[model samples]
Every structure is written in structure tokens, then in C-alpha cells.
Target: MTSLSTSKLLALLALFVWQAHASLANSPRSLPARDEFVCPAEDIANTGCLGPKDCLYANPNNCNTFIRCIANADGTGTPVVLPCLLELEWNDNKKECDFPENSTCPPK
Candidate 1:
């Protein structure tokens, strides 16, 4: 009975820790607004894309963030920084967020 009670206590502790970590990660104070994130100058200068479709690029500096270039009628684009869901990374080949193991992210 004592062992069972101890196990339950440990489980509750783990649950509390996980909840706290998740809440911190999702807190507005921890992340910037989508519009507020500024793309690095290198990313802006390197985009060769032009036209109707938005372009997606992996963020070289941050595995959790990606860049999206919104196409304009004038053949220019505005770069926006975006974050992947927790524990995921940008997958350049598949053009979406994916698990880090399956992504093309360079080794840190």
C-alpha cells in the first residue's frame, strides 16, 4: 500500500512538472507575436523566389522557427518568422513542420 501511494505521488509530481513546462512554453511572454518576429537580413537577401505563391524556408539558426515569404504583386515578398509546434522542426523538403529526425535540419 505504501509503494502504491508513493507511485501515485510521483506520478502527480511528474504531471505537475509537465504542466508547468507546457504553460511556460505556451505563455505569450515566452514568444513574440507572429507579426513582431523580424526575419534575419541574410534570409531576406537570399530568397530567389518571385510571384503568386508564398515561399517557405527553414531557419538556419533555429530549428523550431521557419521563414515564410508572402508573395506580392510586384514580384517581391515580405518575410515572416513562424514557429513550429512544440518538439517539431521545419522540414524544407516536405514544406512543412515535421519531427526533427525526419527533417532536413543541419546538425547543431
Candidate 2:
């Protein structure tokens, strides 16, 4: 390839790398073993899920205060390290996890 073309390609590659790094840094922090789960510190009281199987009581202490625990294979509870269960987002006003689509979060 021509020297100019090579240089342009390299520059583009560098820009892509930089943008990827920035995006990752700005993204929400995921759990250690489960990356699909992201728990923001502001909305979490602890790093665990709550459910029937995981917890002796369903929705212990009104887990609604934080994220809802993940469900077991049979639909029980499994305490996870993530603040909220997968897909459930934190609702600041409601002070709990809720459906993202139903949430009143400002549009991106």
C-alpha cells in the first residue's frame, strides 16, 4: 500500500483503540464472575442478589431498596454480587430496581 494510505490506516486504528478504551472506562462496572450484571454503587446497598432460594425470606428487608436478586433455575432467589438483577435497572425515585423501559430515566 502507499505510504499515505498506510499512515491513514494506522491513525484510524489508533483512534478506534482509544475510543474503545474510553467507552470501557465510562461503562458501568460489572460483577467479577458475571459481567452481564452491572451494579452501580449509588443504587446498591450490598453486592448480592435476593430470592426465595438464596434468602430465607423473599424480598428481605424490602430488597426493593436495592436491586432485585436473580431467580434460580426453578425461579427461586440467587444472591448475586451485582447490585441489581440482570436487565433490571435502578430507579432513583422508586429506590429499587425496575423495568428499564418503564423507568423514567432521561433519554440517551
Candidate 3:
């Protein structure tokens, strides 16, 4: 058997995963209707990340505000409070600022 270098092995694995994702994405049955989407049940208020990645969390107290946690080099997240534009609110399901009518959170 031929010995493959670590980089070459990782590249092959990445290619395989990418191809599988592409095929699944192109499959018609892989996606659900937008209306059928469900949001996670965990309350995300005042959340922060302990890893090296930024995180977005929903503010359960106010639909019009959301928390954007910025990742720091020390493996901590800094939470920033952000407000939605006029007539909009934070949509936890979609993870973005959205129209109030389209928001999944209860009325504030």
C-alpha cells in the first residue's frame, strides 16, 4: 500500500466531503419548505462563546434586539447588543434581523 502524506490525505478527505455535500445540496428532497422550518428551543439570551468563533444569540426579552458575540484571541466572546431597523426584529430561526411580522419570537 502506498503511504500518503498527511496533507494529501486531508485534501482527499475534504474533496470527498465537498462532493457529498454538493450532491446532497442538489437533491430535491434534501431541503424542507421554508414554512416547515423549526427554531431551536434553547433560550439564547446573554449567551457567549468559549471557543474561537463568533456567535449570534437571540434576545428572549426583546425581539427587536439581538446579541452578536465577537470572538477574541483569548478564546472568549464579547457580546454586543444590536437593534433591528425600524419595523424589524431579530428572527432567531433565520439568525438575522427581519421584519417583525416574519419573526418567530413572541411579541415584545
Predicted candidate 3 versus true structure: per-residue lDDT over 1-108, tens digit per residue: 345687789899899977864564233221123233222223223333433222665765567766655545554444555566555787877777788788978755
What TM-scores do the predictions have?
0.50, 0.29, 0.47
lDDT of 1: 0.65
Error of 3 at 26 (Å): 36
For model 3, what is the C-alpha lDDT against the true structure? 0.56
Question: What's the residue-level lDDT of 44 in candidate 1?
Answer: 38
Tell me the TM-score of model 1: 0.50
Report the C-alpha displacement of residue 28, candidate 3, in angstroms: 41
TM-score of 3: 0.47
lDDT of 1 by residue, 1-108 (tens): 699999999999999977875564344322234455444444335554442223676766678877776545555555566677667898888877799898889877
Clashing residue pairs found in predicted model 1: none
The whole-model lDDT of each prediction reads: 0.65, 0.44, 0.56
Best by lDDT: 1
Candidate closer to the true structure by TM-score (higher is better), 1 or 3: 1
